[model samples]
Target: MDRRLFIKLLSQSALVSYGLLACPYLGWAKSAFDYALEGQELIQQKNFAEAIKALKESTRIDPNSDWSYGLLGRAHLGLGQKAEAVAAFREAVRLNPLDTYSRMMIEIVTQKPLPKLEKKKKPVSPLEQEAYSEEALMKSELKAEEGLEYQVKRVVIDAGHGGFDSGAVGKSGLKEKDVTLDLSLKLHEKLKADGKVKSFLTRTGDYYVPLSDRTATANQHQADLLISVHINANENKTPHGSETYFCSEKASSSEAEKVAALENSVIKFDEPYKKKAGYIDIEEILLKFEQQLYWNESGKFATTFQERFKKWLPLKSRGVHSANFYVLRMAKMPSILLETGFISNANDEEMLKKPAFREKIVNAIARGLA
Candidate 1:
């Protein structure tokens, strides 16, 4: 591929900023993550040389930081250093086998140079040009991979707010934790019985598994996908519907922001909160640049998921949204959180309380995955 194949970043609006460290945003001192963030900013400013220096410090602090390595690749790509970019991207994919973004970049770079494209009547922006190149390469790659399809053999189903965390409550006294567990159990069973994909559950019973552990479980299982199931709620009790969520620093809407806040409220129980929140190691920097790519892919998957999930449900489809969900922040693979219905809504709560309705929701999930 030509060095200018990708002239722009993943998305101009995607992942503008992230909580790079655990403590109080970025404190006085800097961490490797801070350097990485600086590198990202430099790249945005089109300062590839300075970006490379910052990213080098990031890798020097933690040689195993795949996301940082991937950033190094982008910086190199920005400088039109094809060999250097390939090296960085390869190291990233090596450190994290599931980094499809880096892997795809490697393939795109090493493949034969793209044929020259005719100039358009309207001048294209860097972002648009990058998109066109990616689209062309992705189509070619998809065709060669498996006719634009892949068989998902492994899946991790997470039941949100286990143990003492009674996620949400309805007027009828239904518990969100209980509902999610039941739905996840059924979804697991159905996926197993269908003989299409092997499924794993984050928690087998009512035990509080930390948010980090949930994604860690998926990584340990080497799962192809992670689906954290949760029931929605609101004080107003009016927003009653099914919506899918993928992770993003900037929430797609206010409703999405609120939903993410509600789900991420349990993070206070996690161990990371104990740290001083500054100068953390690279192993601990879960949210990386690669996450932007994964979240973008997650958004695409959420759309397809909603299309399939809404077919078997009686609830209104509220469509797909993006928010910075803690549980979704660290997933190495594409991950999504499913808000089946609002438990705060009377009709939704009533339906959620029924066994038959739970079954339908699980079936809908299975259908969505298929």
Candidate 2:
């Protein structure tokens, strides 16, 4: 049966079905507004699939309603149904040419390259010329503001543990510090060769650099992103996947907290976090407020990075996590810690030892950063 027919039948049944629609007049029937309102609430609750159902009913009832179509578009976008989102947004714009939200969303969702304006054959009249500069200015401003495009041009690559810090060690005697440095160097080369962005390293050789210094270097370089590379280890040596971590006040999971603790243990060699000193430093206070924004962006970036890496990396992707990583905590920009693989696991250890696998890891990280 057709979906519309199914909806119509469902709507009829909904007349007798309690709490199905937020309709008026004894709840016997629902207007487009009522259905749209239900969709809106469902969307607010982040139940995009159900919201789509209600939004579709609203559009069916009032095909010309711009608000219904706009809500429908939002529902589609929430579910990452991009093509459907664009279609609904276009319909909303078609129904009401002044729907700024839907109009901007269309460009944002599509991300189509801006067409270069062709040079005119003849100069326009003085009146047209007088308006041209201002129009061009507004057009550029609109694209930048409404486009919501984010770019990362400068990245700080941190090779976790140096000098005395050997980091995690495998049964085969592979040190996390050595593997990280090698990977970081390869990643630096890859990023530099790509010429897509500038990559800076916190440590260039076998020397101990404090965790705080790493974040400081990233800030001093004015990096757009900071990525600390490390290998993971577990006592049981069973886990063998890679994970990405972003800084947060609280870990996303127990495993995340443990991972953070393991990496943060290096702080013992560095000047450890002294118990809240007598005077709460103003810098610390400011960081508390500002870091939330950076942390959220970093979390989003970690997710994106994991998705990109999962496609090409041979190691199983353990996904992104939120942890209190000291190296990432003080970053003035978005930061992440990449647990490339489990050095404790035999298979992962052997893979890390291979030059080809290291190259693959470098490429994966480079693509993820891009």
Candidate 3:
């Protein structure tokens, strides 16, 4: 039987059978199921505005339905409401932790800038919520300090891509994985020698680490901060600059989103998250809330790092951006990703190959952290 027809008949049967019982829960389930089906059909017809209305009602009727949230996200995306799309998708992922599609959508939508809405007061995106919470937490911590010194003393440095995952390759044969690993090592040594901060590298040698494991290592170490380093690339080979990124539920721009997508492409290498037996939903919610609080601090630190980094580096500054990076998302501490330079650009590739230039890059990061 056709899947849609089968679903329609099943829904009809459910409504009739439950109507005899006059069960309130059954009424809600039937209505939600019907609305979800209608919304999905409208989406198929490209009637996004109507689909959104139907999906919203579906979600309101059954707030725990991951399917409804996912559909709402799709409708929002279709309308170019990126921030709303991200929020909806995030809820879907929270409800159904195994929903990889919703997780991927969160990554994709976050990389692009939030569209300007005509409304007077704009709704806060998840990124903004995180930043605000982080700011509040920092203020409270500082108030508690009462003149005591505060500092980040331990750090994690992750070199993007490795082993068979060569990352982007330059025309001059310089691989992104090698460059990132070399730079990470140099930065680690510099940080260690500074005596002010202790640093650890996610990988000390050329080998692949799953995107999820990189952050897992940081959380295990109880690190104060994490800096993920990478060499950027573009097909045009004209874009060359240094950019810093912090985790956000929505991307700051289309270009920023694309950069994230490229980095996240390594998700193919990741093994699925092992489902824990008898997981508590409240615990997961609290964990996510705590992570959101750290993101604001990450954003502030990223901006500071970019300012310090641009002063010493030869490359042009692209400034700071925010996007949903799987590597940055799970870290319990402030985390940022650095795109040092575009390997695809001829000039930047040559600079990246030189030891002096690499040392300069290392110095900039060390100084930035300090």
Mind giving the per-residue lDDT tens digits that candidate 2 earns over 115-226? 3335556555554443455457657986777444347799999999988889999999999999999999988988888899899999999999999999999999989999
- Write down the lDDT that model 2 would get: 0.82
What is the clash count for each candidate, in the order shown? 1, 2, 3
Model 1 lDDT, full chain set: 0.81
- On TM-score, who's better, 1 or 3? 1
lDDT of 1 by residue, 154-218 (tens): 99999999898989989989999999999998889999889999999999898899998998999
Each model's TM-score?
0.63, 0.60, 0.60
For residues 1-370, write the lDDT of model 3, one tens digit per residue: 3343333333221212224223335553346656787899997666989999999998786677677788888888777677798899888877766566677667555544333334455466554454456557667977777343326699999999998999999998999999999999988888777789998889989999999999999988889899999999998979998999999999999988998999999898799866668542333343565677799888878888898889988889999999999999989889999999999999999999999999999998888887
Decide which is better by TM-score, 2 or 3. 3
What pairs collide in candidate 2? 163-207, 163-208
lDDT for residue 22 in candidate 3, whole number 0-100: 30
Q: Order the numbered candidates by TM-score, best leading.
A: 1, 3, 2
Error of 1 at 263 (Å): 0.5
Choose the strongest candidate by lDDT: 2
